[model samples]
Target: MKLSLFIFLAAAVLGPELCLATLHNITVKGELLCDNATVSNVKVELREHDTFDPDDTINAVHTDSSGRFEIFGEEDERKLTTFYLRIFHKCDATHPKVCTRATEYDVPEKKLDSVYDMGSISLNLQDNKELGRRYDRDSEECD
Candidate 1:
């Protein structure tokens, strides 16, 4: 009974702090702009591929003074981890429109196996309707 009491006391003292291993580290880098002008100090959102709602974004990053950004996340032992990035910007303050990417970017499972680099994503901020195609090769939406 005394040994059990001692163990309980130790557990209470340690609290919930613990060290866990991180399996994979992923990095996605990109530049953001609206109508040929770089956008700075905007919140960049990273989300699991299936998360449709912006409020549930997993990670938030900010762009530099030059409108360049790098967002990263870690995964542990998951077979597949896909992510999508988005931003919120006003294309034209006088006009109202949606300013985010309509399609999500997919990171292959093999790449997520370790440290992965998604190089040079150039995103153009425009209305979804004006953007035309869903997966426009030129850019992604940021609204």
Candidate 2:
């Protein structure tokens, strides 16, 4: 009888918290440019940032011939999901210190479950807070 009561009390206390997971969906679209010209085939990844857990990749895509892209994804999370876009490209890489330049753009939480259009982004411009650079050893080319 004591064990049964304890279990019932525990369930009453934690049931709501355990069942608070929500499904979040987002659509991200943008145009990529380099030196005022459209950059095609650039890789873009939508990701979720987690606390005390490994980050998750929601979706990934490449820019079209017109440098346009639209990607969407959904996930169920107990806490509010944080999202960002990771762009990988080889723009303005004359020295080619790395295989590609990676940049991140944070998505507004208010844009959840809706389309977030990130107007034109120029890769030639300096990335004020660049995430980092990508180095691929298998690639035999660097320019």
> What TM-score fits each model?
0.51, 0.82
**CA lDDT of each prediction against the hidden true structure:** 0.56, 0.86
Q: Kindly report which residue stretches of model 2 are placed more than 4 angstroms away from their true locations once superposed.
A: 1-15, 136-143
lDDT of 1 at 2: 100
Per-residue C-alpha lDDT of model 1 across residues 27-121, encoded as one tens digit per residue: 76777666777778767766655334433356778889988888877644223456556555444434234433333455566655354455444
The C-alpha stretches of model 1 lying farther than 4 A from their native spots are 1-22, 50-56, 77-79, 92-94, 97-104, 108-143
Model number with the top lDDT? 2
What is the model-wide C-alpha lDDT for candidate 1? 0.56
Which ten-residue region of model 1 has the weakest summed lDDT?
Answer: 127-136
Per-candidate RMSD, Å: 9.0, 3.3
lDDT of 1 at 44: 71
lDDT by residue (5-86, candidate 2, tens digit) is: 9999999998988899999999999899998999998989999999998899999999999999999999898999888998
